[model samples]
Target: MSEYSQNLRASYEAVWGTYQQFTERNEALLRDILVEGEDYYAIEARTKDLDSFEAKVDLPEKEQKYKDIAEVTDLSGLRIICYLDEDATRVCEQLGELYDIDQEHSVNKNEQLDPDQFGYRSRHFVVAFPADRAALKENARFVGLRAEIQVRTILQHAWAAIDWKLRYKNSAEVPQHLRRRVFRVSALLELADDEFSSLSVSVAHLRDEYERKVDAGDLSIAIDRESIDIFIEKDVDLEALVALAEDIGYSIAPNHPNARDPYGGVISTASLAGMSTIDEVRTKIAEVVAKKEPRLRQVFEAWREPDRPPRLVVSKAGLARLAIVLSVEVPQAVALVEKLPFGPKLQSALLDVLRNG
Candidate 1:
């Protein structure tokens, strides 16, 4: 609100649209970089409002004051809040490859902390897309403008959001007595953030190990949801299933959970037909899937409804169980329609699908 900054408001407002466009383009570029492999909790872009920018320019000490409002680095801001603190650094590394990082203006907030301190750990960067990136269709305009990018862990983001909502302009505004308590809360958040990152790394390591075992044809690993995913991704004869599904006028979504969890839902259903090993389950499902045409002829022989085509297209789990049922006792499946064991609605639906054959 100083007269000095008051004179600069119009100058800030003049290029506002260009900066908005710049931030949006910057966000898109960041998204493409992340899509290459990195995933984050959130990514967003915003124009630093006239009010916040004004405060920054006016509030700094006279010796540090900006001679021009355009000197402010965060006139446009983009934030990439990630699940792990390490990912924030990874994001920064990737960003450096795509843009010209204004090293003097940016700071590694995490690196600034003292040995025992736990506080705001955000990475801020001032950057402009390099000429090659600037030449892209979407980024062609607003190529020269720079924006500030902030990367933080979710916990750090949580602390930042709460701190901002409290409207404390700076550390000095918090009561001297409550400052220690605030620091303690930050320490706890820091601990949780580190633990989350460690957990993520550990799980990824375990998955990689399990995938190796699956690749070697190891069936010793217990059939479970996660294990099944690895098996389907690496082990299963998916082409056979796809061909069978198509032959029966059924479309198979290869990515369906049951298809992935062959060792899980599918295997459990196969167990009723005496399938225990992964190989056995795979063979039976393939056989049952292949028998669909013949089985349909048996079930639909008495019922005639050409107009209402039977919804034989079921999820992999249902298909697995239906195969077991048809392979074992076709009469037992018909018997369940009247008894309605799985519940009236589900049993009725089962009858409708099977009767279509």
Candidate 2:
């Protein structure tokens, strides 16, 4: 081994624990910036093992760019894999606020890849702990250490995983014909990635438009989860419900909690009950309030417990559902309960809420 190799190994070993600390502390801090749920495919960090570090430093002069072992920026690397191409940009923005970025050395690989290029794309950011985090006693040890952050959409990640398996360092390594095929494959994946983003945006826009229509009292609009949300938010049937509750002298009110949906959940229930349009939904709610009245209020009151205040903010859409179930004309509530998207046990439990309350 060369004297340089000896010194490099010595330096690494002397602070190997600190590098490991960088992975641990950064993994924790990085996760804090993540949004809840499946916003990204994964969040992970790894410290480069000694053997891999040795191989990198020992590469032939032309291939090995490391002038010193310390120059390798990714000794401790944190990778954030996202589900969509657009998510990568969101992640980078959040990360920028949380850490110091060594932008000069980092690469945004997605921008470099043209439609015809071989698939290797991710945003690499060299990050260090922010001042506030390092100032904390528990995180102080990892203060100056840098870790690479790689962000990519799942499709881009798939290409990278396959490329690593193929061990092809460059597109030129493949025959001309195969290289052309590879280019085609990358283009198709890029197109698919864009389509995913387009669909996500379109669906969100459509939902927003639906909410707007419902807000405008467009009864012609069909009832849906999103639309029903606005209906509940505005306490659309509050006047009638409060009147009924007042007649019974039951306190429901300013704080009455709403059911998420049967209003939405009972799509099948609503359909079976011959209810479809939001106009029909409103009509059925009126009927339930007439017949069930205080009992309808009782069901929402049942949502409360011993000390909590009455949640008058009940789903009027729910009353529409209950009206359908409680209606003597149609198939009874119990029969349709079987079709809800839940297990028999949950169905039985829900039935109990309606029957007993």
Candidate 3:
């Protein structure tokens, strides 16, 4: 290797090392904001030699201009891919706050672009180390070096990887006919992105509606598949009565202590089945309270200062009946019933279930 090549390689290594450090620091910050259920992944820093320094000696005019140039980044690039578009934006925003961004550009595939240009689209940001961060490192050599950060959704990354592989294999020289074919492929990828975005929106809407119906005491509503299995395993099938209440817009809060208590599991089917209006739901719940008052007194007398409140327990048969009513009358009622309180709300939920049935 030439003396200049060795120097450039060393410079690239230093720059690449700095880039890794910066990304590791920022990635830790990103982990804090990631949602509990979502998947987030990071890519390793990629380094490539620009080979620009070699031109300085051969070309006299370029030699004068680049004489002072220490190093140009070898393809030392880093890409951060996020699962969701929102996540991409959030990561980008956090990066902006943490780094000194030079030039930020975004390309939405939905938008129009020149047909002739190579269009593997993504959001690119040219970033430099922050001035404050510069003090942390003694070496001033990498102070002005800029690294390119590309942000893309998973789908965009899929297209980019394929496009990149093709370019590498063919040396980026495409016949005119193949060029048009590539453009068409790009258009198809754009359409796929739009379709995915639309499907995501629709799924969100369905979830919201499910929650609404459950809260309104619509006992006929179907329960979420996973939730149903959980409830059945726990023998808390009566919880479906809460969904019935939710379908009718009755807000039922869970009693955490009672949720685990086998005896306190008594949920009132009468209150839920009887509630036609919001007022009636409340009145029916009051009746359950009136009944539970004497039972609590008896239980307190028997065991003074019990660790937990006595749950208005119902039988397994009653829960099965409630489930049947909810499933038959309001398919979404089971979702609401699952969220109801063990005592009053449970009773009301049961009544709603029976009435709906």
Candidate 4:
């Protein structure tokens, strides 16, 4: 209604126009780098008119300092809400790469605050338009002026919006009772974030386990023992056999013979025996143990021999003896077998003792 109010609205429109162009360019760039399954959401930008901008000018000194207050926009600005906390970090990192950041702060109060003060969390960055940007001169009012970028997980954003509406009549007057209630709400939000993070971790672990099993070739042992039986009947190299099984969706373990976690697969081995390829190592280990009936008992007995010790020991003669027994050439055998789950060094040492004896 006032002349100053009209001028401020016009300036805000100009700033908003620049913000639109900047966000559009940045959002396209973001789409390219985000992972396939990850969620990408909207980007919003706004500029304040006189009424909103003047609302913050509480002090007499502040009012006197800016007589042409209508021209000064951006009292409150941009926000990005991501589906997950991880995504918030990703978006912030991407934003940093694109924008000329003025200031950056993270309010993860849940982590640093006392139990009493726990609540919503977000990452905020103030960014100015790049000097070289074509629109910089046209939008000179927003050139040196910084726009706030608030990045928060979806849940945090929800709490923030609700708090913004309900918590204060004005930013300056947050009564004590409402402040206490806000802290309690913040605690609940933190708990929600923690639960989501835990769920994400659990899902990731399960995915890793499934992938390992699929790679190792033991998925069928429990459901279709016949698959293992057939592979053994064909004398397939254990590792290759597992690869084949994995291609068919069967789970398998890694090559290490003494692997404590069967699904973890073998990382290294002691004997450096029959294994010549990764697949051969894994498959052979699985073949040696899959039946777990007569053959496992026999192999265990042989491995437990006072001289053999059911572990691979690394030594020249021991290695050579294993190479001879497994009928594999020394180098390939060593490479693949060394990846067994048990202590390859110990296995090789025992093998040397057996050869000498």
Computed on alpha carbons, the lDDT of every model, listed in order, comes to 0.67, 0.68, 0.49, 0.48
Q: What is the lDDT ranking, best to worst?
A: 2, 1, 3, 4
Tens digits of per-residue lDDT, candidate 3, 1-357, equal 456445544655555566555555544434555442243455435544344434333354433333333333223356777666766677778777867876423234424334454446667766666888666655355566666667777777877788778772231477766776776776687777678778778867766665554456443433333223233333222344443333333344333333444322222333345433323333333343334323222322332235634443334333333333333234434444554443454545454444343
User: What's the residue-level lDDT of 207 in candidate 4?
Assistant: 54
TM-score of 4: 0.47
- Candidate that would win on TM-score: 2
**Which pairs in model 1 have colliding backbones?**
300-357
On a 0 to 100 scale, what is the lDDT of residue 303 in model 4? 47
Candidate 1 global lDDT: 0.67
Q: Which of the predicted structures, 1 or 4, would earn the higher lDDT when compared with the native?
A: 1
Model 2, 1-357: lDDT tens digits are 555655666678788788988888788876766863355778878999877776666666624455555677889998898988778888888888988889898899878765445678889999887888779998777777888989988888888998888766467677787887777777788798899999889878977887777678776767666555555555455347546645553443332333333445646677766666766766656665666444544544454456755443433444345555655342356667656533343344446655664
Model 1, range 273-353, lDDT digits (tens) per residue?
455555554555566656544653343322334664453444444444444555555565565334423334445545666
Q: Please give the lDDT score at residue 224 for candidate 3.
A: 37
TM-score of each: 0.74, 0.76, 0.50, 0.47
Candidate 4: regions farther than 4 A off:
1-41, 54-76, 104-118, 131-145, 168-184, 220-357
Weakest ten-residue segment in model 2 by summed lDDT:
252-261
For residues 1-357, write the lDDT of model 4, one tens digit per residue: 444445545655655555555554444444565442364455565555445554445444454444553323234466777777777777778776766876533244335544443344677676666766537555454455555667777788778777667754332455676776666666678778778878888767765654455456544322122222233333334444334333433333333544333222222232334233333433444443353223222222334556643342232222222323333333554444444423454355434433432
**What is the alpha-carbon RMSD of candidate 4 to the true structure?**
17.2
